[model samples]
Target: MKLVSLITAFSLISGLVEAGNERKFTTIQPDLTEIRKAQATAQPYEFKEEYVPGKVFDRFYNIWLENTDYDKAAGEPHMKDLRKKGITLTNYWAVTHPSQPNYLASVAGDYFGLDHDEFVRMPANVTTLANLLDAKGISWGEYQEHSPYPGFQGFNFSNQETYANDYVRKHNPLVLMDVITSDETQLSKIKNFTDFEHDLEAKKLPQWSFITPNMTNDGHDSTIKVAGTWSKNFLEPLLKNDYFTEKTLVVLTFDENETYEEPNRVLAILLGDIPEDLKGTEDDTFYDHYSLISTVQENWDLPKLGRNDCGANVFKIIADKTGYENIKVDMDGVYNNKSVEGWFSDKHIPLPPPHCCE
Candidate 1:
């Protein structure tokens, strides 16, 4: 009996030793020499030619409306007017389900795993398109309607009696990024819509500007008709102005769709100084939120963030002039996930509260 027990113990010890050796061999780290060699072999993309005057517009303005599906916007009267007057991008899609992630992805190359519209702050190290614009000495600003101050960091502001949403932090992506909020100078650039008018009057508008309407006007707490009417009224005067019309590109788009089950297709319009031949035409090229960042990079010959922006398609006009090539990607595979429920469950974070003002 003692001899049998000794032999069994020896067999068990040998098995354990073999398992340990297997793990050690499989988990070996790559050496510095191998890393250097891999980096050396990587090829960087080069543009065919330097940026030309007509390749990209010098000024860019983006207006992001709230949750409205493509159907609703297509049926709206004012939306049709804008479509008739400007170039329409019929194949544009939102990057994700919620509003915040789409907005973040528009400025930053990626959404950074944000699945909720909570008042969450991003790490300061995260780079944004504002950083890219700043690096090239281009001016940028965010004009949020009904915001209390230039750099207010609150979650939401509402009217006391009506309880209507005046401004919500989640709608403004610049406030969530620490890179902008940390610097006083940069923070001051994020001003209220009133300041936008003042800047326009003084001809002091930034080269790149993002505009967000209040909850009601943006169709979040109201109907598509309301949002369309407000946009038409606000844009008619600006489109007629010579200062705003010359060498300027204005993009009007939505944050996301109303239904998570449907494809995240949204209405997008391009106006203001578009090439004469392209006006009143439709472009069916596929585009996502990262395309906004990629378009800017192509316009100014700026460096990419090496994230999703690396794979995004450039705007059609810019592509025509610069001979830009888009990275091939499987769109259906990329946007398969619909709701944020799985992400919220995995992170153990509470779901976003319903909009009380709505």
Candidate 2:
């Protein structure tokens, strides 16, 4: 009876109860028609070119480290290894005040005036990179360490005795987006780190992956050295594995800087299957979190989001792939004037039009 009860509970949780004695799995693949309907409602934007020949990458992986300054990361041992094996962006800066905005900007092109890390929910109609990737049939998923389960909606999960945050919702940006959380099928893709190892071993990695280490490993409640060592241990083997490296690109970056007074510069490295000639080189082009969005779109021949992505610089490696010339942007002209001042305040206003090519 206990066994039967456990099975019944799982069936209810999965919405796949057995009919009579035979069990049948329900089809929960993403609804293409619904995706198209939602995408049609988004504001249209044009790509710079009508067509691009081939995609630069077969897979994309992003690993976001926590609040780390550019100077500190330069001295870390793992970062040194990355510098030797990959290209580093010397002039990369975080877009806004805090962690949440930077994460949101990476996927949504605009932070939408977010100045704080409060628990705010995005409206369902707002289009995100997930929508764009799904529209093109490109697979995407987020792997968050210490998360309770796929589609867990809690704000924070902590170990009982220590009271230290293991998984914080603020760090996992996809759960805040309604488009991903509204559907069980989409939400299931936002899984814990254990599933990541399983999927990797099974060769079921998605085309685009957003990975966030737990608070300790991500340096939220720890030091950059801890995060760096954790990253080295976790990523070194994957970097050496041909199964994971072939035609794959992995970006390692921090969420924001520690001090608000200094310019929001963070360390960013492009590793994994980097072009032979460009390896161990540095690109000083000015870029922020939005560049991640632009680079992905450029690589996959997808349309721009028309937010900061329109004005953002694509990664030089991707530019080399698409056969396009790289252009530098005047960072001084860009401003963050859309949010009210306060750590917990929620008064967010719309940003002015982007100054593309200015």
Candidate 3:
């Protein structure tokens, strides 16, 4: 059968677990002796290579916060402090409701209409931003806070003691794409915070990365203030570290807004090597998750995913490098509060096919 027909057939079966949104395994139990042993014995993954100079920044990293409205995040003290140290993206919009789709969009260029947080393994042929990065010999990795082990395939993992939401697969961008997860070499790149510390100290960090905080720290189960303070504490010393901040562009952004009644605007900041005059400035460029992909592609002269990323705006900080013009979105009748029907949506539409042939 064809890929589309196979997907359609899987969709029709209620009990079968062929692919998209199926529970192959339950959540990981960190307290179990065997599980603890596995986690302890798992080797940490690292990616280090010669710096591939980009048009502007040499290193690109993004830290995603939880559901937060633009105004709420802007008013927070720590967020304001971070804003003063970087360029604030005032017109950044998330693609849809909930967090999973937006996270997936950051790497995949499209979400395949994912509307909720669930265990999903896209077909192997789907290409991602990582693929583009690899084509240029640019190393990449994912830092997942509180994940039980390196390249963990579980759907979710709670804080063993408090039983709070710790690390969820939904917030992980690279795990959603089978192209990366199915390959052991690529999968090993997803490591925990301990590995992050080791890599940071050893200077084995990759040029490109997506960092996801645990639920409480990201404000998914708490408040935006928690996320902001954690973000500030996490990034403050890195700014002073020469190795970490050298030609690095770090973005502190949210997955989506807390309110579904308003436009899906979220606060995003660009941090790294800002001049005295440009610091604390605001860029009202219309941007979304896909913009990050386009910005990276333009900076590194990489191939486009040929999805929403192809037309997304490049960041103004490096617009001079690409000479690409960005437009301010007229928000008169624009509303992205709701997600359009797609494969994972409640009433599924079959337009956006899984890129099994990419």
TM-score, one value per model: 0.79, 0.79, 0.88
How many residue pairs clash (N, CA or C atoms closer than 3 angstroms) in each of the candidate models, in the order given?
0, 0, 0
- Lowest-scoring 10 consecutive residues by lDDT in candidate 1? 19-28
Q: How would you encode candidate 2's per-residue C-alpha lDDT over 1-358 as one tens digit per residue? A: 3423543463354333222322122222234354345434432111122222237887888999988889998789878887888899998888777788778778877666466776766667667887888888777889988766666666777655687888878888788788778987788788778778887786777888899998999888899899989989988899888888888889999988887767788899999989788888999988778888878888887776666677567888888757766666555634332332221232222233433433
Candidate 1: residue 196 lDDT (0-100)? 84
Pairs in steric clash, model 2: none
Ranking by lDDT: 3, 1, 2
Q: Which regions in candidate 2 have their CA more than 4 angstroms from the true location?
A: 1-54, 331-358
lDDT of 2 at 318: 82
The TM-score between candidate 2 and the true structure equals 0.79
RMSD for each of the candidates: 16.9, 16.0, 5.7
lDDT of 3 by residue, 4-114 (tens): 355356445523333354223244334567667877677766675788999889999999999999999999999999999999999998988778899988998877667
Regions more than 4 Å wrong, model 1: 1-55, 327-358
Q: Which ten residues in a row have the lowest lDDT in candidate 2?
A: 43-52
Error of 1 at 186 (Å): 0.6
Q: What are the lDDT scores of the predictions, listed in order?
A: 0.74, 0.73, 0.83
Candidate 3 residue 346 Cα shift, in angstroms, is 7.3
